[model samples]
Target: MVSPDVFYGALTRASGRWPLSAAARELVRSGVPVFPCVPGGKRPLTEHGFHDAATDPDQVEAWWGQHPGANIGVPTGAPSGFVAVDVDVHGPVDGFRGFSRASRAGLAEGWQFLVTTPSGGMHAYYPATPGQEQRSWQAARAGIDFRGDGGYILVPPSEVSTTGAVAGYRLQRFNAGASSVLDSDRLRDFLDPRPAPRPPENPGLQRQADMSRLAVWVAARGEGERNRGLFWAACRLAENGVPASDALDGLSAAASDAGLGEREITATVHSAYRAAHPTREDSASPTVRDSSPAAPDDWFARDPVSRPSSVRGLG
Candidate 1:
């Protein structure tokens, strides 16, 4: 498989209008297998979808000749030497935020270029690991999808007809940094993490496992209640003897999935634990014994005056 950098270099150098037929042939000549999708759409024109991708020049010529305007489909992962992190923008969900979170976590990076999809989404192409097989996955809630092994992507110069307008996939930008293989597994985990493992034999861990529902509830918390909800849930765990660190471990990812920032999640969990078990300095208990006195010297014992003498005007 040719590196994406090399593939892209040759692809851009090919001169022409890059019409469907010409672009298909050019991809074949550049050593990337190609397939046809329905004209102005994503559904495969061939019977087997991406499995029909071929590098043979004659097959390429025949397919494009028959369907002159079929969109170009390139198999990702090993077949094309690259995988894509697809950022979907739909309704009220903007995947760019989730992608940003992944990038901050050092998961999604080193892409060849960003392809603007017809529906205004983005496809970030990254080099695939040579020997490793990274399967594709979709985090629907996060609005991000991975196109790796067993998946395909529509490349540049392919147009999709939406409503009434014809919008084409275009190169948004090229990455100047060193392009490296993305860890798709890690990226998926960061975006939409799985639930904690089943209950373990250890009693403490077993108890923690039983509280996984709390984490799920926290993740489902919406805008106004996210922080307060997480704090309340964490407090329940802490009050039941769940360690602060364990609470952090269990709730951090869930709270993050619910749209809480890392720092806010940490602080909230710690706050819950603190609230569950207040510190000596924050305790409100009386320092002296309750039975010690109610005498003049025991003014301290007189129900601990609700107001200072000066405020009460007691001379």
Candidate 2:
């Protein structure tokens, strides 16, 4: 068996070329699923997006032939047997600081490949655990995100338009012969670190009650109500000082029980969390509930600002 170190070394060296099309072909040869991205943009040319990623040389050649200047995009997650930790630079939190914190917490130490993005972000590549179906997440408060199942990332040598603030993406670190891949469990732990135990207090009990109420509210939601309900619940959770991971875990399960798909639940909850907690600090919790019965459409049409001050935080 080819050792992991040897495989990573070869993959890293193979990624050094400038021509994206050629690089795409090389990645395909190396067993990494790849597809053509729109020239100077992140959108994939394939109709099915990352689902169309393939290792077939003929298909890759055909894609590049049609769009010679297209950029290279690699699908992450199970398809490529890897996940990417994307540390972005634009948020209030510093990406490097968050990464350093994770490292200090004993995570990401085994990462073997790194890429610098066009927007001054970093992408750390790690091998995916077999049969694991991790999903993309925007850890906005921490300035980091995960690109896994159902997501794609543009690879090095792929340049965005110069009109943008960033120049382009480039390869940074590659252990030419490293024998290990980053542990997905460690990465997940870093991303969703367990909350430290808190002392028993009235506030903690109150928060639990609030969370249960929110979960019940989410569970009561039906078709066309998932997104709005999740957004509202997430906002409430943020107000109650619940951590994002905890809130996502509880609310996602409730959403699933309400017949919402994983994708919808993830997107809705993340968006709501970011909107609710624009800063790292917790917002005031909503105490009043609108008890008036109303049409589902009416409830959905109401602007977030029209809700209680605490709920309006999600706006």
Candidate 3:
């Protein structure tokens, strides 16, 4: 597998009218899934298993003569589902320049919005067929686009709400290996304490997992009640007297007491912190639910906070 750093270098290679999305579109056209490296499922491509999909990372790597593993996203957009759209770049010379170049290029290509990811150095989005796979990729890009495909050249992570049936976007460096080669359970373990130096797209997505954590936290409660609990916790964290950290700690304690634990709280707190102060970069989350096999048992079960009775309870 290529090192993440090397993969990143590939992303930096994208320049001029060849916006990342265009790069990704080209990749998909050639048949390759973009896999962004992130611990856990914070992004779908990172989380998705390839064998089930009849694809393999080794095959992709072998085909590209690239490493067997690298983080990137796959093309979730249905080959047939793409729509025309426009794009706008929001600030600074660096971003605007890249975007403008891509924009002009996209226009030349008959695309309304093709170059975006680099404009923000983070998240980006593209309109395409919607699906969970797409959602995760967009989350990972932090600021890139490609309705779940094209990999890193265009997609980046972002919390920005995408309108339409399309899920989200993601980006890539070169090739992000195939999702089929990874062992689902092994992947979960690798993500349990996902290494840092994480891309802007990582941390924020973990918070999405917290929703599932919240659901599991309020295990004694129904789905609606758990949602209410999460909302209440967010409100508490936002209160004037509460430090965001304190609010999350307090809320996490409550969850722990309810039978959840530290790992859950840790992951959840990171999620909440990110929610309150998102970098334009953070996006994507593991696509699996809390209890799903796709999720690792490491933190949630072994975490000191994972135990409800040992932890503090929330209001």
Candidate 4:
């Protein structure tokens, strides 16, 4: 894999007044796989999205030859040998403050390069740990996203045109100091801290706290795992002695935010409840595949009464 510094250098050379096709070719030549995105936008132009990213010069040439204006998209983490901390800047949802807090906590330094995104946001680049698997996650409420494994980011010079206005990503700063691999887990915890479930003398307070954290976890789940995550969280609540109704109520809005419908959320919660307490009294057993006995150490696994929970981010 190409080093982060080499990747950043290639990107810098390709950016600024270079044709989009030239930029795409430059990256593939550096052993960085890249794909074409919609002209002036972030949407993937290919059928399989970032999965179609390729390092082959001919493949990249064919792609850009067809759409010269397409923006360059590179998969993060293992595929590109780098990860990104995306600080978003949508209206009323600036992430700089949270990023600043992370930096103060000494969790946001060691970035290889800082790129200014089209929307006036920031994408801080960091080298991927050589053999570690860091998955992607979004702390939407925090207005930040970690583009690690299973995620992609538009490289410098990619433009976004909205309402006839066009803006491009630009390399703003390069860190000449030693670049370090980011501990995505630590950064996430610092950005959106959740209390570890504990045995409480105040049971009511404990339930509320656990449910809140679980709901936040559900809310943060990304596509392809929303339903499964909700089920796991609901099951955690059930295993912790919380009622089914409360689980539904606690996780409803969060599930909704994660793009699950009312019915799906309701069904998943009920299924989880049944799975947690499979009694003959349950007239109809849940048949959903998610209800199939999850191992104690599955994604977002926890034994609230015995130990701390370990939540997995999207991958």
Each candidate's TM vs. the true structure? 0.64, 0.61, 0.22, 0.78
By TM-score, the better pick of 3 and 4 is 4
Which consecutive 10 residues in model 3 have the weakest lDDT in total?
135-144
For candidate 2, lDDT tens digit of each residue in 214-260? 67767766454556667867765655456667777878888988888
TM-score for model 2?
0.61
lDDT at position 186, candidate 4: 86
Q: Backbone clashes per model, in order?
A: 0, 3, 70, 0
- Residue 280, model 2, lDDT: 44
The order by descending lDDT is 4, 1, 2, 3
Q: On a 0 to 100 scale, what is the lDDT of residue 257 in model 1? A: 95
Predict model 2's lDDT versus the native: 0.66
Cα lDDT tens digits, model 3, 1-315, are: 222333334334433245333433344333444433322222433233321121344444443343222223443334322321213233432333433444454321222122233223433223343442232211111111223322223233321233332222334323333211112122222222222221225434654444344434444432223333443344323322234454455466556555555666556645543444444344433121223322322223321112112212111
Model 3 TM-score (2 dp):
0.22
Candidate 1's TM-score = 0.64
The lowest-lDDT stretch of 10 consecutive residues in candidate 2 is 306-315
Error of 4 at 138 (Å): 0.7
Candidate 4 local distance difference test against the native: 0.80
